[model samples]
Target: MDLLALETPCLILDRGKLEKNISNMHKRMKTLGVNLRPHGKTAKNIDVLKMALEDQAGGITVSTLKEAEYYFSHNIIDIVYAVGIAPVKLDRVVALIKKGARIALILDSVEQVKFVAAKGQEYDVEIPVFIELDCDGHRSGVTLDDSLLLDIGNLLHNEEGVILNGVLTHAGESYNCKSVGEIRDMAETERAMAVKCSELLRKNGLPCPIVSVGSTPTANFAEDLTGVTEVRAGVFVFNDLVMAGLGVCDESDLALSVLTSIIGHQKRKRWVITDAGWMALSRDRGTASQKVDQGAGLVCNVEGQPLNDLIVSSTNQEHGIISNRMEKDIDWDSFEIGSMVRILPNHACATGAMYDRYYITDGSTDIIDIWYRINGW
Candidate 1:
């Protein structure tokens, strides 16, 4: 069955484009001599995870325990919970570790060190943990100069059941970069900080072994990996409007799109309503800060190409309004009911969560497989 055969308001992943994206990123990272640990938060489908691990050593980065459990049950051994795991989730972490999954958690505070150490001693399980260093003060990470990384590293090293693996960081500020050249510089600086912190730990005799750095923008533009050992990138697997705006990838490289059918139109309002709304495309206005703000999503024709003078201006709970980006009037009669269209999402992660399963289209653009996704904690 083709795309038209699938139920309306469904998500679809083009097999050819997905493979091309994976191949392109793998080739790029291999050229830099760094390990690729693709983030699993983009496409949580087991099929996509298998495709991501097919060429490499199969190490992955997951944002939550459920994702870790999902991949681990499918034989993904070396996994890293990239998020700062809380104490409430230690039971799930211990369970995954007991099942033979070599998982590591992220920590940026001495409080976390004490928490993990106390929990490890209580559960009698050796939990490997990584200290997150703030490379650019973009998000959750400790400053390299704060001595917190070493403090936490030494604390864990001296603890009874806790093992300090290494350092990890995400250059989230790279997303706000002006150009790919800026992104490359950001990558270099981010890697340097992570490496420098790791060296500091080693100088203190903490035996910092694993040094990790990850960000989609930096990963795509990085040409230097002198001290970086591994790179974690999730959005690279499914390029979105944000990636496109940064010139990281072209519009064609986007693998996932929401399929929506025109349901109604209002001539006076100069808008066409579709079955897809915030529920189908998500409400993540990722392009709000970009040069061109994509309000909800970019309107595309049924063939998956951008529509001329068309944009999803606004979206409700279950309805989407489509109109020209400018204030010019539109011929609502041209858009007949039952016309199917695709909406390129703003954030691939948020949009992917809006659907339960993906209508896997093969090389022929026919619905071949339906890959289910597991949600919740």
Candidate 2:
């Protein structure tokens, strides 16, 4: 059961680091006076999810209905389908509702609202839903001043089968920040958006209660939660290079990494290829605008410590190019064929999605256990 003895090209999660991250996030949310509905999209592993839900009233945010089913089957309730629920998935959403799972779906447009309301009526169910607001308009969400909020609220409020629960916003822009202070500003801005949107709903006579905000970058640096009711941050459960770049967590706090072995060495190129590639690491070339560009990922020693002068540099399908800051000074023969190494990913969600199981370890780097992951649509 030694980790070093385990096969290469595996996923290893540090037990201590994982718990530290969980505890850190829990304390931060408590201090901010908001509910921490950790996002399950990052880890997705039952073991990791369980650690994330500690003393948190068992609420979670998932990107897919399958994840909802997986967590619900495990007895975790109070789920939020963070993504916009399409009409095709209404049946599944209805099924989860019937089973007493307190669920909510996101709506950003009038067309979507009408469709969801009609579906809810046909299913003879009261669908608790949240209106997705575009705080900074990073991706999918309605604008703060968009008249659609009140319009959709009024429509769903009067509907016999639909209930407008609250407003939800994700500070996805927070990830692009360069410093903890910048992340703090993003958090405040997210809270402000949630609060302001709630006010707009209330002014229009809609019973607005929940004000949810998410994104690990903001969650870690956010100082005040005066109006937010709940916070939904996922990657905090397993810190990644993306989070580390924003100073949300130390590089050492990262719990997951891609395990690879040296496959070939190009001494002249001053680089060594590993079995791990974009398939093992991910194609998430995260926020290259930052001071440090972690190509595909940061190269780490087998024990999960980043090699200061080394980086994955470049990656292609089924291959990774490892090189040091000064390629000329890089020692290629130092890493011969069969030498194992670990690469810390830029985005844990995307990278973790590439694997089917996690090779769990207690930081010994000599003993490892495998925790299978759920994949597919």
Candidate 3:
């Protein structure tokens, strides 16, 4: 069925773009000489996972345990619960391990280290772990020159049932880099930091096996991933307005979009009101601070071709104001009250989470497939 026949404010994924993105990422990882453990936070759909992994579940990363369980339930066992593992979640991780999930946990503080160690000992199962090394201080992770990494490594490896898996770092701040050169520098820093941590652990007589590092921007621009064993990136699967703004990927590479219908119009103000609102498109103004401020998202036609100079300027709970970014005259008659439009998201992970399922297409309106996504904690 066509998307026009379906309800508005729905999610649609272009299959061609999706495959191309996956293939491009795979190729990038291949050239980087690292295993591509694509993060599953974007599309929590098993179908999307299968495509991204090319049916080979080498290793995947999840931001939430629900995603870990969902992917594990689908028989994809190797996973890294990349979020900072709270002490209370040890039981859940143990349960997942009992069910044949080789789930690795991330740790930054010594408290987390001790807690995980205690749980690993109590459960009598080897808990694979990674030290979250800080790269550029974007988010969680120990400082680059942190002396505690040695202690954390020893705590994990020396303790019974706890195996220090390796060191992992993400230069998430790489997203803010101005040019490819800056992204490359960020990627190098990320690689160097992870490698340095792993080396430190090894020097301290700890078994540090995996040296993983990546962010969509860094992974794409990095030339030397020498010591990096694996790469983890999520947003590259579905390029967004932010990625396009950073010049990492083009608008054509964007796979996911919100299908909306023109419900109302403000002729005097030249605003085309859409059924899609912040609730559907998400409130992530990731591109707002960039060179191009694509208000909520770049506006597109029914078939997924982005409309020139059109953007969702403002949004209410259930309504979106689509206007000309150039502040030119609106195409009043073209977008009839019932005419449909597609909206490319700013951040794929945030925007895709709004919908439960995605309508799959190949740039055409044909709904070739429907994939359900896992949500919640």
Candidate 1 per-residue lDDT over residues 290-346, each given as its tens digit: 987877988887668787668889999999999888856876665789978889899
TM-scores for all predictions: 0.97, 0.97, 0.98
User: Candidate 3 — which residues are off by over 4 angstroms?
Assistant: none
The C-alpha lDDT values of all candidates are 0.87, 0.85, 0.89
**In TM-score terms, which candidate is top?**
3
Ranking by TM-score: 3, 1, 2
Write the residue-wise lDDT of candidate 3 on 1-377 in tens digits. Answer: 88889898999999999999999999887876788898999999888888888647588999999999999999999999998999888899999999999999998888888888889889898999998989898988987577788878777877886788898898989878888889889988998888887877787778878998988999888999998899999899898989998889988999999999999989899899999999999999998889999999999999888889999999999999999998898978879999999999999999998989999997789999898897899
Residue pairs clashing in model 1 are none
Best by lDDT: 3
TM-score of 2: 0.97
Quote the positional error of residue 347 for candidate 3 in Å. 0.5
Instruction: TM-score winner between 1 and 3, please give it.
Output: 3
Model 3 gets an lDDT of 0.89
Q: Which stretches of candidate 2 lie over 4 Å from their true place?
A: none
